[model samples]
Structures are given as structure tokens and as C-alpha cells.
Target: MLEIKDVAFGGKAVGRLEDGRVCFSPDALPGERVQVTVTRETKRFVEAQLDRVLEASPRRVKPPCPYYGACGGCSYQHAAYDYQVELKTKQVGDVLGRLGGIENPNVLEGVPSPLPYGYRNRITVHRHGGRIGFHRRDGKGLVDIEACLLASDEVNKRLAELRRERFHEGARVLREHASRMGFHQTNDGVGALLQDAVSEACGSGGCLIDAYCGDGFFAHRLAKKFQRVIGLEWNERSIAQARSVAHANESYIEGDVAARLAEVLEEADGAATTVILDPPSQGLDVQVADLLRAYPVAKIVYVSCNPATLARDLKSLAAVYELGSATPFDMFPQTAEVEVLAILRRRF
Candidate 1:
């Protein structure tokens, strides 16, 4: 018997097995009593597959998608959308306290996305065994899907066209961007809220140095608010596009920000600046944090998707900067993914 006490960060239920070993059961909800079959086991913990829910929580609901359990697309489909946000908010606070060594950090409730369903602007589907669809929960095999509920209507129509066009490649990618299919927010509606949150965190002033800035999304808007804006990205195509629309005060540089950050800071010449970091899911290196520590940058507005690495980075940065409240945004609903925006002001 397993008593699911709470839900973990990756959409698994935190529970203890009969042998007192901590067990995680996938596709589970908190407050549920269940019998599980152990799939994998370690010395400290065990991973189990859900067998049967002897007692279900009131918040547990029937999943909307037919392939909810099989397809790796949606993890929280069995959870109510409001409950999903609540779990994510709690998870963010837990990580901040446990990993970041922050005692009772100011963490606000997660902001829900404007459109939860049908919000993804891009997706890459796999083609295997005559099935053109997504990967399974284990991320090994393909799950044949007729349609994806998370994709936009335009993307779904394109999926249908791809099926009819005999485009039976190993994978099919869907993108909303006109120029090139690169990295952009899958949920653009919530992305606006993220931009607003970052802007609010920075509070309108100083040089906006947008690291990993793609197509000048944040830098262009902040150029008017600041004396100058510098966007650094490795993508040459995105840099070209950004340069084409650059204002007189805005400049986009095509290079690795990490290598050129010190040079850029030297050029800034001790001006008040906010270094905006929107890194990938892998977070950033300790060297980046070290540079921020040595530099005189006034503020840092960090946008992150992975909390574990975010906590690690914040812990390192805490020695130099004063940590502020962390705000989470539900950029991807019905999934384990959560977007977090954290602000750190320089300590005197």
C-alpha cells in the first residue's frame, strides 16, 4: 500500500512503500491511496507504476485526452487545471527553500495561462511503425495520435496535411514562426505575461542586456525604456533579423554571451544595468554566476523552466545579490513544465 502524501516537481506522487522506502508513482494525484508495482528501485528510493487507486482525491478528474497516460505530451491531464497550478506553485517554493537554502522565501502563486489548451505554437512528432505521432511516457516508443489537443488549430490542420502528403519522415516539426523554426515560447499568450513580469521585475530603467535574446523579443521593447539595449545570441539568423529591426540605441550581437559577457560589461563602463538571463532547460554554468558576482551589474531578472538548476544557480548568486520573491507562470498547462521568473538585486 502506498499513501500519496504529495506531488513532486515532475508530476509524480510522493509516497512510501510498505518497506518504508520512498516511492514515486507516475500518473498519480496527491492524497490518493494506491497499490503500485515497482518498476525500478534504488537503495534510497523506488519508482513504481500505478496499479490501482484504492482511494481517489476529490481533485482527481478524468483526463480529457484519450492518450493522456500513454503519450508523453501531458502529465497533469488527470489533474484539474487549477490544481495543476497549485501543485506547481508549491513545488517552486519547496525547491527555493530546500535547494536554495532560502528560509520562507517570498513566492507568489503561479499565474495561469490565458489559454491552457490548444496553446502550443510548435511541436515535433515522430513517425514509427506507420504511426505519425508523439513518444510514449517512457520516451522510447511512439504513441499513435489522431490529433494533438495542445497544438494550435493551424498546426493540427498542418498535421492532417502532412499525413495526406506522404511526408513520412522520421519526424515532423511544427512551428509558428515565419522566419525559421527555432526556440520561441510554445505558449505565446503566456509569454506576453512573462515579458510583463520581467519588465516589472526590472522596474523600467538601466541598460537592458538581453542574454540569449532571440529575435530581440525583450530587447526591442526595453530599448525605449533604457538608454541602450544590447541583445546577445548565438543564432546568426535571429541576429540578422534582430539587426534588421534594430533601433538606433539597440544593437544585436551574434556570439556566445558567456564568452563575451565580460567584454560587454567592460563596454557598458559601470553603467546601471539589468542582465536578463533566459537560458535553456540546462540552466547556466557556475562561471556565469561567477561573472555576475564579479561584475557591477545592478540587477538580474532570470527566466527559467527547470527549477532544480534554477535553485542551484540562485544559491550561488545569493552570496552577491539579494534574492526577491519568485513568481511562477503556467506557461504549459496539463504538463509538468512550469516557467519561473526570479529577480535578484545587487547587494550593497
Candidate 2:
């Protein structure tokens, strides 16, 4: 038996074996004693499979979904909604402090989803042989699911329709929300809160440079706050969509952000500029960091889905910028995935 002390960033509860080796188990919670069998072992840590809950936590609750343990889609169904948010909030702070090398990072409480279950606007299911559903929790094969508890009603209805039809061995994406533009957030409720945070961070700037501005998600909404708004992205399709609803003050360029950012930064006044970075899961490129350091902006609002990469990028910019606030958005509620908005200001 091991006492689970904390939940790690990647959705595993951390505990220590009798020999002092760190162990990770997915179906366990903090403050609980669990009996586990080691599945994989490394020099640094051990991965274990939870066999039984020796001492259950108060936060543990009956999972509503019948396929909760079998399906790989959701992890926190057995945990209370508020406790899930609390665990994720701590996970963000832990990752930032450990990986980013920031002492006592300013991490705010996680913003809870309006509806924990039935919040997902879309769900992707795979079909293999006779099974048609998501991958198993162990990831060895598919687990046939009648319906997904995390998916919205409309998405579930489409899923039901897909179940009746026969398809080749592949994946099917059922979505309720429609976006003509590219790369919109999956959770619409939390997505609006995310935009609000970004807008607040970009308060009253003269020039706004939105890097990796897919479909001008922020650029279009925040054009009125700045005298000039420039959006940089590589996707031509997204740029076209952004251009279709272009504000008078907004100008979008279709090119690599690292290649074109310097040219725009050279012309904009550094004191009056606020650059918004909504990079991919890998975070900002090294060249992009170098350019930002060379040409410092007044403020930066970085939006990231992966906390580890976000921490690394924040550390890279620590020399020129000071951390203002870090807010966690529970965009993907049931899973361990978290979205963070980090605000930074040029150091005096």
C-alpha cells in the first residue's frame, strides 16, 4: 500500500514506494492509500496500476459514466468536480515552479467548468475491427462505448447516428459546435473566460501583435483596444477567414511568426506595444524568444494549453519580463489537460 500525496501534471497521482522510489498511478487520488502493482519501472520513477483503494479519499465519488474506468477519454470522473479543479490548480503551480525555476509562482485558483459532464462540444472515436469507440485506458485496444458522458447532447446524437452506419477502420470526429475558421477552443464556456483574461491583460495598448493568431481569435475581438492590430500566422486558410472579418485597424500576415515578427516589432513602439502569444503545445521557438528579448514589448499575454512548455517559455523570457499573474482555465475539465494564461510585463 502507498499513500498518494499529489497529482502530477500529466494526470497521475504521485506516491512513493517503500524503497523511496516515486510511483505514479492514474486511477488514484491524493490523501488516499492505494494498493498497486508496478507495471513499469525506471531509474527515476515507477508506473503502477491501481489494484484497490486501501483507504479512499473524501474527494472520491461514484463515477457517473459506466465506461469511466474503461474509456481513455476522461480521467477525473471518479473525483468530485471541485476537487478536480483543486488538483489541477496545484499541478500548474508545481510544474511552473519545478520546470520553470520560478520560486513561489503566482498561480491563481483554477476556473471551474460551468458543466463538468456534457461539456465537450466534440469527441473523436476510433473503430478497430468489431470495436467502435475510444482507446482503452491502458491504450492497448479499443473499448466499445454506447455513449460518452463528457460529450454534449448534440455531439452524442451525432455519435448515435455514426454507430448505426458501418465505416472502415479509422477515426470519426463528431462535433456540435461549428467554426468556419481554424483552431477554436473546444470548451465554449471556458473559452470565453480565456478570451476575457487575454483582453484584460491587453488593457489599453497602442499596438497589438498577435502571434500564432489562428483565425484571428483574439485579434478580431481586441482590435478596438489598440490603435493598430497585427496578426501573424502560417495557415493560409485561417488567414483568409480572419481577413474576411477583418477590422479596419487589423492587418494579418500569412507567414512564419519567427520570420516576420522582427520586421513588425522594428516599426512598432516598444513602450506602447503588447504582444499576444498563443503558440502550439510545443510553445515558442527559440528564435521567437530571441527576437522578443531583443525587441522588448510593454506587456505580453501568453496563452498555452500545455503547462510544461508554457513554464519553459516563461523561464526563457524571465530576463526581460517579470511574471505578473498566472491563471488556470479548466478548458478540458474531466481530463488532466489545463489551459493557462500567463501575463508578463517588461522589467524596469
**Pairs clashing within candidate 2:** none
lDDT (Cα, tens digit) per residue for candidate 2, span 1-348: 999999898789999998899999987999999999999999889999899998999989998888887888888887899999999999999999999988999998889988888888888889998988999888889999888888889988988888899888899788886554367777888888888889988997599999999999889999988899999999999999999999899999999998999999999999999999999999999999999999999999999999999999989999999888899999887887999999999997
**Residue 253 C-alpha lDDT in model 2:** 97
Write down the TM-score for model 2: 0.96
What TM-score do all the candidates reach, one by one? 0.96, 0.96
lDDT for model 2: 0.90
Looking at model 2, report the run of 10 residues with the lowest lDDT sum: 177-186
